[model samples]
Target: MKQSQSHDGSNAQIGAPIPSWKVLIADSQPDQHDAVGRCLASLRHDGRGVECLSAFSAREATALFGQHPDIAVVLMDVGLDGPAAVQRLIEHMDKATATWAGPGLRPRVVLCTRDPDQWPERAAFEATAIDGYVVTAPMATDRLYGAVLSGIRLHASMIAQDSSQKGMARVMVSTAGIFELRSSHHFYFNLLLQINSLFNIVQDSLLFVVGDSAPKDDVARIRAASGRFSALRNQTIAAIEDPRIVSAVREVFQNGRTVQTNEHFAFAIKTRYEVMAVAFIDGALGLSAMERQMIEIFRTKATTAFSNMMLIDELNASQKAAVFALARVAEYKKNLIQGHHKRIERLVSETAREMLQRSFHPEELDEDLVAKVGVASVLADIGMMVVPDQVMHSTRVLDGDSVELIRQHTIVGWEILRDAATMLRGRSILAIAAEVALSHHERMDGSGYPYRLVGDAIPISGRIVSVVDVFDALISDREHREAWTVDAALSWVTEESGRLFDPLVVKAFRTVVARIREAEPDWLATEIASPALAGKITTAKRDLRRMIDRITHLLN
Candidate 1:
């Protein structure tokens, strides 16, 4: 006997064939098969009824179990064959189901017998992986129905668990892929997008960074969003129009737990660096238990990934700070003014930004590259630390040997930075700094020192820093020459555009100088006394003092 079922229940079309769970009855007696079939004919679980399959002997039962691996329940008669035959059939079924159906889909087995003394419940359960037992003499219809129903329910639960595990595995793989993205904004956005996709939910989701560390505002702020909440990205909690959503997010953050209702679901994820909240709008209301479990697993993985990303960010910031401090030490040893490196940093940053805006070296220019070159500009003359103090501070004209000794600073600086780069595993900022240290003295016409890298052979970072470093030096007072007027310095740079500088770089430098003049008409006249320059000078002094104190403490 077969029974059919439909997902739509009574609303399903009449007479249309629907899927059903398969229940196999293995018994030598035809009457016993009929009786068991009649007992389960009207039974249903999870909107699906059972279909009965019969096998008359142990051999036939093994074959049937193999053929219908999807069968959810098996009613085995212990007396159909001898006890040894029954044991062999059970073994065959176990092996077949494990091989053909996999972990969660193996059918439940209910052993039936007329002799309860021979096959005691404890012994039957201890011997085989049977789910239930029934006595055929009494043949209670309710007991048979209950056994079949329980088997079907257990099978459904296992399948759901198996599916959830697979879903989570895929989510983990995708999470790893997204972590490869460099930008935090893109990382969070794709994370929310993946969560929505995994559950086949509407893309209405929002991820918020909670606690006082959030940028722009200290309170919770939306860092990533999709669907109708897209415009709310980077906005504070007050920007969300839905009061319920706001409340739920606050609850999660305050309690550090998950909150779920019919209309929304929100959870808090705490990392070593910050607290975060992920909320799904309306889409999470109707998810199954398996889906909820999967979401929990995804939440844990995302927290770990987010925490690691934060740690990387912190490490990068620390590296940049260390690089700047090293450059400052060289500056102090050279006895340069407190703000000289800071001014070079500003000029290089402005020139690089201008070059980027003009689309110079489009293949190589980006915001990250611009920032790196700017920070690296301070290290251009780090090799000056190797110059003899007498030659470095000479008031009179230097002879050829003195000049040669000073020029060796470039190579020395390059080696210092190159070794540092190696120590850092070739980090890009250090690599760029090494390039600047090596080639800042190289002129466009191959007349410069070190390698004399001519024209485009010079790394763009080196080229930009070369022009700015020379301009800064030319306009600053030195023991050998009085400070040149801004006009004189500009005239020299413009005249040497192609001969000594990359013409494109000189053009961008000119724009940068123009912007500087427009912003501070008395910039050179005020020199280090200008308000903006003074602020930077004070900060440099403080940082230098802190570095000196740290070194002194270490020595002590």
Candidate 2:
């Protein structure tokens, strides 16, 4: 309830990189937007002025905030979206504060209402991070200006003191990448690196993740050492010879409280998954009382981020397991070859990774692209489950109508994936999977399937999967024909070129195919009757010219 100084452009940092502080206004009234915008028109601080954003509805407000993570302050009309909507928005912003890595910043919230009788109860949202409260009735320009300026100041102050928050935010960013880790080795080791970076990176510090002493299915040994002890980055504790450090780790794990001395510091935090994480700092311990308090808070925040990342990985693993089960069900109903979907997944992953490695399509291959494509590729032919058995396996040659009906499988698979739309709405693998399911059959030249989407219109994922899907299907057995030879399959893909595949995608696919041929020429020669080559292909040792030569015989 404290007042803010009237903005006279005195506080703005001159020649700073930022030109303005973005202020988003959420209200349904056309006049209100104009009023707030006009009031702050000339308002400047440190040479920075206010840029007002207007959102007319709750959905609009959600979208605006989602798009503009740099929004410094949000002034909302509680009566328009109502107090309940405002509370939900506040809660969302709370969960999001530690995830942003941009400018080391967080948004400030102010609730405004025209009616005193309809004021939002302070008790309901006080626990949330609302920075100011404004009542419009009998309100003066100075008071309004004070409220808005106060919100911006609060935001600036939060940013100024964001050392700990930014630490937590960086940890969250790494933890977010945890969901995309393709292997457990990378997951745990990368997690250790992230956790160590969250601290002061003390040399001679050691971290011990003690699992259940008893032999259990999930529990495993993990320990890491840094600084003077950098040799133990990915090492276990079984080979330790330093009795003093070993004993210190033991005492901390046993007592489960942070302990420090003139030259040593130790702390333990029990994770949500029932693992004891104990760290012993072996460097300087000159931290004052306040510094120690801040360290403890940082530890708690970092630990929470770790737990949340683990939970997301678990959920993603479970969802993928279920999707794989569904795909297996589809395969069973149609009596398709074993590991049909698995082969396609491996091929898609292999081809996509090659594209990324050689910079064929850099923009499309973000961090999660590998894991997302891996999970989503299995659902590429999931639409086949909905196809009637007669159409799926009719011995007689089908008419145009039946062929078209078969083509509808892509749409059917997409609809099934899209059913979980609410949970997979963003730039996530599940959404990418849904898109691939619907559009993988689409061709570069508008020559293939139900949609006939061309060129870049087909998602990069879809284009990658399309090339993999056809090659896998061609080289695998079916009711109609035996699996084609590897040489024949690659030649067919090459022949299609711009007609059936993205030229760049095909170029990448050819190299991947050549590597597969080099490593396992047997998989290339005969029909792929089983999951014999379900594993990912390793990097090829040969030059690109040799790969072309291996396939040139077939191309001729």
Scored by lDDT, the top model is 1
Candidate 2 vs. true structure, TM-score: 0.56
Show where candidate 1 strays beyond 4 Å.
1-162, 181-186, 200-202, 210-218, 231-235, 238-241, 274-285, 327-371, 386-399, 467-543, 547-556
> Each candidate's lDDT (Cα)?
0.76, 0.69
Best by TM-score: 1
Provide the lDDT at 141 for model 1. Answer: 87
Q: For candidate 1, what is the lDDT?
A: 0.76
Q: In model 2, which residue pairs have backbone atoms overlapping below 3 Å?
A: 9-44, 11-46, 12-45, 12-46, 13-46
Q: Which residues of candidate 2, in runs, are more than 4 Å off?
A: 1-220, 223-236, 239-247, 259-266, 280-291, 423-425, 511-556
* Candidate 1 residue pairs in clash (backbone atoms < 3 Å): none
